[model samples]
Target: MYDVVIVGAGPAGLSAARMAAEAGLKVALIDDQPRIGGQYFRHAGVRRIGGILAPRFGRARYIHTSLSTLGRCGVEVLNEATVVEISADRTLTVAFRGSITQLQGENVVIATGARERVIPFPGWTTPGVIGAGAAQNLMKASGVLPGSRVVVVGANPLCLLAATSLLRCGVKIVAVCAPSRPRVTFNALLRLMRRPDIFLRGVGYLLMLKLYRIRMLSDYRVTDVIGDAKVTGVITRRFAEGLPPSEERLDVDLIVVNDGLLPNIELASRAGCEIEWEPSTSVWSPKRNADFETTIPHVYAVGDCVTASGVENSLLEGEIVAISIAASKDVGERGRLRRLSRLKWRWRRLQKFRSAVVELTVKESLDQRPLTDDTIVCRCEDVSLATINDALCQGVQDLNALKAETRVCMGRCQGRTCMHTVLALLATAVGKEPDQFKPPVPRLPLRPVKVGDWLKKF
Candidate 1:
């Protein structure tokens, strides 16, 4: 038994584990990735394994220091460990490197982070089309560029980051076609100024774009990805009002697109924690109280898994949740209340900024381009928009019902890649809000665990 078992090694999980262990609680940190840093600090955990340090910088250095602190605090670190199941008694069954082990924690923290939301366009499943987050993972983890020439599409800010990262990697960007108009972009930029650090980072990205003389088109949406077997080019259409409609084609090997980020809440939902859909972000997260404790007693969720705020907010949540858990255990009683109050005040203030960012950036709905019947919605199950429409015609009224009729979310990904799009379709069909529909039933094992590994648990 451990005093605390935290899932994920992202900013929140790392901070929580370090703080809890520093308070003298036995702690175990688990992550599926071989590296400790999540998306924001991708590949930051690599050290001088053979006496050669990786090129480190701001994000990398901070994570390295936190990892070192975790080591000094005696936290058991389990990299590449997947938590497959959680029992009613709060025991976690983890599959690690072809074996299984069970851990019971007095307190458990879920910080699995978020996944990139990809809005489907025609031919999106082509070999060269990838999510902005996935493109970053490819570049960061393996030093592989997504393509020689790329066109970024969508209204989200992640598109800019991906384009800039590709620029740094010497990949040529053909253009960036955003669906939002110039006014929306300007508003978001003004709101971004509230956080100077973020504002500067975004400005630096824009500066790179301008310095390279790359084309940045506003109020343009990707109508289709034109390729037979792989992406060769993309079809973009201008959507601005009071302007003659025009179509443009860009020759490119890659199309990197992002809608937003959605919480990876499968583990928490499967563990029987209550979940609520937040209309503001259009993502469902594990329901938690002011203390950040989930409906399941002694189980807490923080960071992007709670909501897809930025890295700084996630780090702060980690500290607050750890302090709450430690105080509950009476391990660090002195000044706990005062520290919690101060941290929460900071958190709430940051959340206000987050709200403004979301308001300025997040659209009421995805790109309003007409989704063709041939567009692939669920790649894993090979479900198409036509099939979904057929199901809706047959009286499917909710996501769970639609899933039963069409098997959309029953694939290996467990709705990670496909749920948001399906939810949008269903909500539109039913003439209700996204939150009005019931979420798909949570299934287990949360991830695929081989039969051999399960047997080893015995």
Candidate 2:
């Protein structure tokens, strides 16, 4: 049994493990990825694309130092361990190396991070269409270009960053299309002015676009990623009507879609944490106190898995939680508490910037476009918007009844990709708030496992 078992090795979990281990706590930091660096810290050097942008600047020293510190402090780093289940008893059922085993923790910290919130439109299921973060992983982790010509579509700041990174790698960026009105962007920019660092970051994205001579399409929205078997190009149109029936077509093989992100609350919720809907981001997150512990005692949550705030907030939260744990054991709590308070100040400032980011980002996007009746809402099940609409029109009051009638969320993904759309359309059709509808319960065996593998003992 370990004193602390962190479910994710992202920035939050990494910092938490570092602090906990330095305080002489037995730590077990687990991650499903091959390495410890989370998606945000992917190749953490200031230079983009592993120094392709400039001839100088080596890999980040801090990343190496952080990971090394954990080893020196005797923290157990468990990479490629899939946490199958997290129980309220502080027991974790982990699938380690094709075999299942149980690990007990005196205290558990959840930091599973976030997943891309995909808004499906016509032809989005095309093979060449991928998430912006997926593109980043492909290029950064595996060193493979997504495509020679790419069109990064959406209003997400990450979309801009991904496009810039691709440009640095010599990929031809056809265009950057974000479905936002001038007024909406202006309002968001006005709000962001309160946070100069974030405001400048936004400006830097625009400056990067200007540097690359790429036009920002505030007027146009990507209607479809047109392709056969593979993505050949994309179809974009201006929102204004009677504009000569013109459509802007870019011949790009890869289309990266960005529609913001939502916390990966599956594990936390399964652990019986109380969840509340966040209207700003249209997602649900665990309810935590000032100490970052969830409603469940001894169970803590931090980072993007809680709010998709930022790495700064996540790192601070991790350290704060570790300090809180140390305090319970009477191990250097006074000094740690002082450090936590200082970090709290930084966290408060970061939260303001995050609020501004949410205001600007989730306001409008390519996801705003209404889906055609025949558009496939659930790609995993091949369920179309028309089928869902028909079910709603038939006065199916209950979501389960709708699902029974249409098999909407019965896909392999179990509604991860399409639940947001399902809830929105259902709420709109029933004339109720989206929060009123209960989401379908997530089942176990999140990743498909062979029955034989499950039966194997440790």
Candidate 3:
């Protein structure tokens, strides 16, 4: 049994592991990916193997330094290890390669991170259509460009970063379509103005795009993606007030769409941790206190898994959670409250920035008219959105009732893709608010695990 088991290897997980190990706690860092860096700081190539770092110097350096520091700190890094289940007793059933293993830990830090949100449109499943974040992952981590010429669509700060990264990597951007309106909350704007570095970063992104002569379409939405196997172009419509309905076809090899991100909270929810829906990010995040401890004691969550904050905040949170856990064990001279206070200071600073950005960028609910009766909702299980609507029409208002009827959110993805859409449709059909509807039912084996591997636990 280890003193701490970190269930991811991103910036947050790495920072947590480093702190735990430095505090003399036995730390085991596990991740499904082949390397230490999770999606945000994804590192490619073998250690000591030669490869060119992505032009984003800060991100690349952070990943490299953190991995090296973790190694030096004696943290046992287990790459490509998937945690399939977490028991009440803190036993983690993990699948590594073709076998399964049970690992016990006194404390657990879940840093599973966030997945990019992609809203389906016509032809979205095509090969050339991918999430804006996924495009970044492909270019930054895999060293493979999503396309030579691309059209980026989204309203997040990450969308701008993705565009900048693509330009640095010599990928030509055809156009950027941002659906955000010019008018934002005054409070959010004021908070953003206070952070000069963040404001400067925003300016720098605009300047880079200007210098590269990339076309930008503010208040525009990608109505449809056009192509067969590969994307040839995207259909876009302007969102300005009093604007006539004009459709434009922008020629591009790839369409990178980013709506926003939702917490990858399946494991936490399945483990019976309370989840709270945040309208700002339009997703449920695991409930945690000031010290990052969840409703269930000893199960802490850090990083994007708990909040919609970005990488810097995630790393700070990880450090805080680790210190808190260490203090609980009386491993160091530092008191828990004192360590927590320091973390709170940093967290407050970052939260101001995150709140401002989220307020300014989160997508408002667009026209989500329910899909046809036969339209598929859960792509993983091929469950139709039509079937889900039919169940709701038959008075199945509760999520569990709908689950029993249509099994829309009961697939392998476990409602990750269809939950929000299903809830929205149900609310529309029943004349209730989306938040008023019951949340999706949580289940175990939060991630897909082989049946044979699960049986090994017995």
Best by lDDT: 1
When 2 and 3 are scored with lDDT, the better candidate is 2
- On the 0 to 100 scale, the lDDT of residue 258 in model 2 is 78
TM-scores for all candidates: the values are 0.92, 0.92, 0.90
Model 2, 1-458: lDDT tens per residue? 89899989888998899888888889999898888878876663334443355212123454688789998988888888888788769998888878887889999999999989888888888898999999877776666677888888887777877887788788889888876544456655565665687668667878988988997776677777777799999999877655553478899999988788878888888888988898888888899998898999999999999988767777888898998888887785457778878878777767766777877673553236756888898888899988988899899887788789999877877787888788888888888887886565467776555677788953
Best by TM-score: 1
Backbone clash tally for model 1? 0
Judging by lDDT, tell me the better candidate of 1 and 2.
1
lDDT of 3 by residue, 1-458 (tens): 89999998887898898888888889999999987878777756412211334564356677777767777878888888998889898888888876788788888889999887776555566679888788777776667777888888876788888898888877789998876565577787777775668678988998999998888887677777677778888888776778785779998998888778888887787667888877667678888888888998999999989875877788888889888888888885556567778877968877887878877784746353212454456777777656676677788867777878877777777788778877877777778777675455456666787888677768
lDDT of 1 at 15: 87
lDDT measured at residue 299 in model 1 versus the true structure, 0 to 100: 88
Worst 10 residues of 3 by lDDT: 45-54
Predictions in order: lDDT: 0.83, 0.80, 0.78
In terms of lDDT, model 2 sits at: 0.80
Model 3 spans > 4 angstroms off: 45-54, 184-186, 333-340, 366-376, 383-391, 404-407, 455-458
